[model samples]
Target: MRPIQNGITDAEVVFTNPQLNQWVAPMNGNSRIRKREGTNQNAGGCRLAVDSAGHKLDHIIFQGGEDVAVSEGKHVIDVTNGYLYGNMMLGRMGLEADEGFCDNVADYGTLSTYAVNTTDIKLLYYWRALYTGINRANLLLRSIDNPDVSISQLERNHVKGQALFLRGYFYFLLVNKFGGVPLLLTPSQSSSNDAMQQPRATTKEIYVQVLSDMEQAAGLVKDIRSVESAGRVNKSAVYGVLARVCLYMAGYPLKDVTKYADAASWAKKVIDLNYHKLASSYRQVFINYAQDLYNAEESILEVEFYGNGTGVYNTTGGAVGIVSGIRYFNTAGSYGYSSGFVRPTQWLYDLYETGDLRRDWAIPPYRYVGEVITN
Candidate 1:
């Protein structure tokens, strides 16, 4: 509860802290879980002890619930950033066994199905990261309404809206990849075996929950465009995501064609808001992304990254350039470090007719220093 009141980001709470980080480590490996016998014996940090009447001793950590709500609100940006990038988004799309790949094509070939095996660490990490967001959101929802909390109605609405959006967004990602997963609305008290083995929900039930959360979020999130930070979700972005969810619902598997109407209506709402539009030059969009120039008239959302020349690699630090840029020595001057991990297919190139401005823009012109490489 001290950790919760202090408002650590979901990642820190799950990975950095001593108590929760144990859940991530395996039980029987060389890296055994440290005994909790003396975990809290050393009192370097302050502790918050409240009597039944609700009197707190630690002033630093036990700030009022309003402050906690504000801290929880900040997690929305970090959670969105985590979801927008990472292996789940890039690997899923990039790993297909396509002739476009210069290397590791076989890894992503039919063999790639093993990448999603239940025991796979990377895939499991994706699931955990999403559930971390969901848990934090649930905690926020539960705590925001406490009688001791003193947030204004507007702040309460904003926090609730952001939490709902994150929960819905994460659930949408899960259902798309793994189909129905256990719908855990309450935060798990401990990572017990029983908690880990909850049964799966139906695909329909999952989507219903996602839609309900997002719809409620839309009603509460207002003035998002004026937030002074483009990284934050606004009303337009909520509607945009809702539209995307609806489009997915209308597709195969479920094939509920009625969702097409919902998709169109939500998309029309985004367009009607006039929050974003087509950039004059399609190529400039990537250029703007490289320069971190968000809030372009054409930009709806952009995941951000930062580099500090750290000795260790930070996945969420936005190192995508190391993956998808121009390959073999960065000839194209693209920031993705041009790993050439993914190349363009000739069929993809042929799809565009002459005078199609986006064809060359979308596909890199690979001139690899005197070699005419054919894939």
Candidate 2:
């Protein structure tokens, strides 16, 4: 299968009609191409196009979806460059400060100082990442059902289910952050279409769509045990996310008290699955993240990062431990380097009771000094 040359351009030009021979120009200002007339020629054309487009669907789900979900990569500028770090890191920083657990350093004081606004570059990055994921999912869903494409019914359901879940999850993130956003469910065939400029859907309407997509996906997707990796969405992950969504609906903004029962019901479904359980220790959860180990029993879903910042796979390294771990500057030492941009506050320290194992691990009382820990 051929790789996608341009994501948006390729997605817009995918045609399934077997009767028209119209010339089409991609939205990216690429050279126009003419489709030859005849049924056989159109079928051959669809097969060729579907092969390349199918590869693109897989690439976006695995690579682009991961970047949007976890916010990895080195270039902290453009979201398409695999530098969607603002999504998770910025949210974490803001939440830590808001919850009175930590304070951001002056050097990285955007969220902590309440300087963030609609025009913030970080917000723009995250917005672009989420929409890009949605667009990719839309393209996949629209193209997967072509009669010329060779795929089994079971495989088609699996792929379609994943696309629906990703689209719903992206919408869920957008609604939580921006309250309301334009909902574009279908693939955009042209930039000139008037329908492309959709008005923002209501908060409750967006949640309803999210619930529908996820509920349908829960039935179509593979079970947690059937999936090969925890990174891929499974029945358990959908159920857990459904629970979270219901709880959100039950809180401020929507404040739909009826959703509380739904949230409990979804949570119970996850528990009744008998597939997942809490880890032996809370510290072990973070340890597994730092070591790139998969604890499927505990982590229902995860964003996967691979390799160090070197060679062809350099861009796959994550900043999980480096940005938030204990302060350290020795590159050759076992502790490695940490910026320690956010530090725990005294209020957070005093909140923890005696003999709390999580207190020391979450808010470390020590620092790394030349390969040694010092209190």
Candidate 3:
């Protein structure tokens, strides 16, 4: 099979590199049976393709759980690092810096700093990216039971569980952002206007579906201990997210007070599992994130971003530190560079008590002047 190109017409190739090409086998009628390749691999780097025949089906189905996991993994990063990060910057939680007021970050900052309408390009991108994620999950869920797919029942459940969780998670993000959106559960099979247009579901209705998807997912996915990487979602992650979802449902829009109890129940389930605990130090948590270390005990789920934009998989790296981290500049490479697009507000900093270690790590009191650190 030939390596797919960027902006390929027939396939949704998220990432294409030499490393991905080694394991991401293309699906054709001749080779319908395939096994997932590699353990603890970067699933975000996997690519998905649609053959000429399958392209007409309106969705691409992978041959194995690994393929689904790989494709979904990229979506996970897009949602967390892309959409969710934008949400943080837009909200009062993070103040957008002047540097962020230009270029790509400006698209998002404009929505917050100025009066913007639904027609904003950034909003459109966010909507499309999220729905794309939901559609991938939907396709996986629809294809898991096909006999043509060679995955075992166990493998099927694993992927299905992740898909359900992801679909629900995508919808959760959507409902939080847009209040109500057109809810599409099945994979798109037609390009007709009738098939394309969907009425917006009610906020309560969306929450109900989210709850169903996550609750079912919690049962199907593997335990956190069994998962090799924090990048992959497991039972604990599902439970934790479910708890947060319940809390949202119990709040302003829905005002479903009963969900508070549900939230507590889900939160308690994670505690009962005994797999996760607070790290030794508050700084270690963020340090683990910066260093790309997996400490499942504290970090339940994370979007894995690696490399330095130099290797074959140049797209593997993310802007987590560069955008929100401290600003520094030096040509010697002794001090890393950060645009510092988002900074903590004084109110947020003051929320921390004098002795709080998180105060310093989260919102440092110092700045870098050339090669020297200064306060």
Q: What is the TM-score of each candidate against the true structure?
A: 0.72, 0.72, 0.74
Write one digit per residue (lDDT tens) for candidate 1, span 7-86: 11211112223443332311111111111111112112111112221221111122344433333212322332222353
Q: What is the C-alpha lDDT of each candidate?
A: 0.52, 0.55, 0.56
TM-score of 2: 0.72
In the range 82-196, model 3's lDDT, one tens digit per residue, is 3443233223212443222322345455654665576676666566666766765665566566565544566567667877888898789888877887888886542122223
Q: Pick the candidate with the highest lDDT.
A: 3
In order of TM-score, best first, we have 3, 1, 2
By descending lDDT, how would the candidates be arranged? 3, 2, 1
What's every prediction's RMSD, in angstroms?
9.8, 11.2, 8.3
lDDT of 1: 0.52
For TM-score, the strongest prediction is 3
Scored by lDDT, model 3 comes in at 0.56
Off by over 4 Å in 2: 1-87, 100-107, 189-197, 290-292, 307-316, 331-336, 372-375
Q: lDDT value for candidate 2?
A: 0.55
Q: Tens digits of per-residue lDDT for model 2 on 58-144?
A: 212121221122111111111122324312353454455634433544534566676777666655656666666666566667766
lDDT of 3 at 223: 84
- The clash number for model 2 is 0
